[model samples]
Target: MGKATGFLEYEREVPGELDPLKRINAWKEFAIPLEEEKLTIQGARCMDCGTPFCHVGRLISGMASGCPIHNLIPEWNDLVYRGSWKEALKRLHKTNNFPEFTGRVCPAPCEGACTVGKSGSPVTIKNIEKAIVDRGFQEGWITPTMPTAHTGKKVAIVGSGPAGLACADQLNKAGHDVTVYERADRIGGLLIYGIPNMKLDKGTVQRRVDLLAAEGITFITKQEIGKDITTEALRSQFDAVVLCGGATKPRDLNIEGRELNGIHQAMEFLTRSTQSLLDSELEDGKYLSVKDKDVIVIGGGDTGTDCVATAIRLECKSVIQLEIMPQLPLSRQPGNPWPEWPKVMKTDYGQQEATKLYGTDPRRYLTASKCFIGDANGNVEAIRTVEVEWSKNPQGGLIPVEIPGSEKVIPANMVLLALGFTGPEGGMLEQLGIERDERSNVKSELDHYTTNVPGVFAAGDMRRGQSLVVWAIHEGRKAAREVDCYLMGSTEL
Candidate 1:
């Protein structure tokens, strides 16, 4: 809630992004920074509605409607509108430890639930949040603060992803001796590897990692709990354990020519690209660069979008994204009510780049891959695909059927399977003997993060399956609270 009459006086606006053609030449964030004065006006656009559904953070009709972390959106918006930069930063850090990441990538369901969005475009909540945090860091307001006194309890966190990082930050704040275990060579799990650096600067990830290192949280990189360090040793050494390994098993395309040389999983491609960027020598003959190659990304979700952007930056000859679902409408449908998140089609940075370059959207909706056409050298040369339609069967579940004579082969020397992820890898879970849900995710009580094993808790994607970074943060905080309670026998979280 910023200004009572501000909604009527001003319209919503966001920062301009870099030119698509120019931005595609390099791996850098495309979104232009909003000026401070403009941010104040954007904050003023907050409607101050009687019911602030923006931060509800609940499930309604099987879809997320608000900020899952229950961020103090209205309070921060009002503070920003009043030009209270420090106050806004303070309110932002209360619920979100890392606003910079969420600001960049979060879908901002809060905006959808905003009262202003009902009538017009909503306030630039995500941009304002990013601006506040960035200003805080620039002004040296964000520094690591070690706990006043250590509780003498040790907590072992498995995974350095968002949830694990949040859990470590909160647990450290609560005076627990926390040790984070990561299998990767560095901290900031997917934030470092899975996400391309152009969208999120690795330097930003390193900055947070350094801050946490200074805050007395011990990070043991290249040390896997189940493999490098035995789970038994961790449980014996630490009073409590929090599992945040994340859902990392990439969903594979099991169709024909699945083992083709040129075809790679989205995570693999992203990982190689990030590693190459991190270490120039790592790019030595093995890395997958789309330079001078025709790139085809399968799946139209965020992962596929990321592939498109990455491929463009790699100077690929062409990039095409195929989605099995039909294209979305431009605006909200009648069925999508005010409180529910709207399913609408819009241009993201990658598609915008593809449009600017190729003169059309990179996505082809309602498309399905039949097989990979490989060259004599065993490398993929093209993709055989056809259009698909979904219909309800006699039972109730919808089934996808391929249309006759719709088959076509598209040129592609490189293909990235951006289909998505399965549950978390089974190494740690099996080593600890934790029970998995039917979907292979760590099964825990709805609100509780505790696994069947005593003194062990799982959260984030590992427990809930693939999800957004904001949800991972929420899961981490909640799991930390539960771990704190399990250790102290009180609701102190």
Candidate 2:
């Protein structure tokens, strides 16, 4: 440890963010970086616990307890505290392929399992990580590196999300040729489109993409395996094929007037907005406009929060987020103990912006939309909602029961369904002849990512269902190791 008593002497601190109301006026990252000295103080807060659980990366009670990619947190913290930033960056990149992405958007399960957090505040691990990588970029420490030797084995990956990129990077480092195919016009599937620029700037995603391209990984955008090229053709050409296409099928509300105009999936709205912003700085007018419109966003998750922020940026007249689940406690409950992800309340950037603009939190908990009410022109005009209470059903499972006489109507000009995804889209899986599990995810063992078909593998959301980007990176790395072994009967990944 850099300083044995540092944890006792220092308190946790993070970088400041732009004022929510002011930041909403433009689509750019709002987090202000902490100075090197302040970040060093934050790094000194890492405890000298002999058994550090921050990198355990295990699931406890169906939630991530630590870093899924098993980041070396304590080592980097020590290095940062000692002012050895270059060394700290090396330790960070040893495990995480994209610290910039995770540092910006990861929920930081590592901090939840942080040993220091058991007693007081957790170390500012996330901010320190971002600082190290961002510094590495500024100092030109990160650049293209050619492999020492080529194994002459070519691999094809059918996605350009975190999982696919991680897999390509690992394979390329192992002296194998790697090609990544993306269905979208841009390289990053989720990072570039599904997430708005306010949360994670598109330039950050593109910078990493360009670096990977310079390192010999081929990127083919606007090419889908099942559509533009057949799965069989891809398999025949490549020595191995790994599927990292994410679970992108948005869950739909099957209520009356769902087919009405002015209602859209959250991804559709986000993707179009990001594409337009990048193409013309939003001058293209290709995205759905919500200006001066009362927007109702259903579903209470990260995606829902993103919708709220995006609507605010577009200058919506009013916005509200409806979550059927009851509000989480301000502190951890009895069921959620130390080292597990705290099921406590958190005010994300989007919610903060809404609060600043509207003078109140825009979230309405324990409320569920009953149906969409439309005007004669077939446009959604309002939403019928009812309050719900969760109770144990006959099967001893929790279920939301609607309360009588709790129905109400809320005016809405646009409705965005931010409900989570069910599973990966079926078209590509069907084309590849891959078997699906009961939950419709690709059938593959956890550590061994190989599917039933020879030379074919699956990883990330396509195999594990919807999950965090860090987990996707872990899956991609594991799958790459397995693919390397399958091809050469051994691996050093």
TM-score of every candidate:
0.98, 0.99
Give all candidates' CA lDDT scores: 0.90, 0.93
| Model 1 lDDT at residue 111 | 84
lDDT of 1 by residue, 78-142 (tens): 99999999999999999998998999888988888888999788878899999999999999999
Instruction: Return the clash pairs for model 2, or none.
Output: none
lDDT of residue 238 for candidate 2: 99
Candidate 2 lDDT over 29-141, as tens digits, reads 99999999998888888878999999989999999999999999999999999999999999999999999999999999999999889888999888988999999999999
- Candidate 1 has its poorest 10 consecutive residues by lDDT at 278-287
- Per-model C-alpha RMSD: 1.2, 0.8
lDDT of 2 at 434: 93
Best by lDDT: 2
On a 0 to 1 TM-score scale, where does candidate 1 land against the true structure?
A: 0.98
- Where in model 2 is the C-alpha error above 4 Å? none
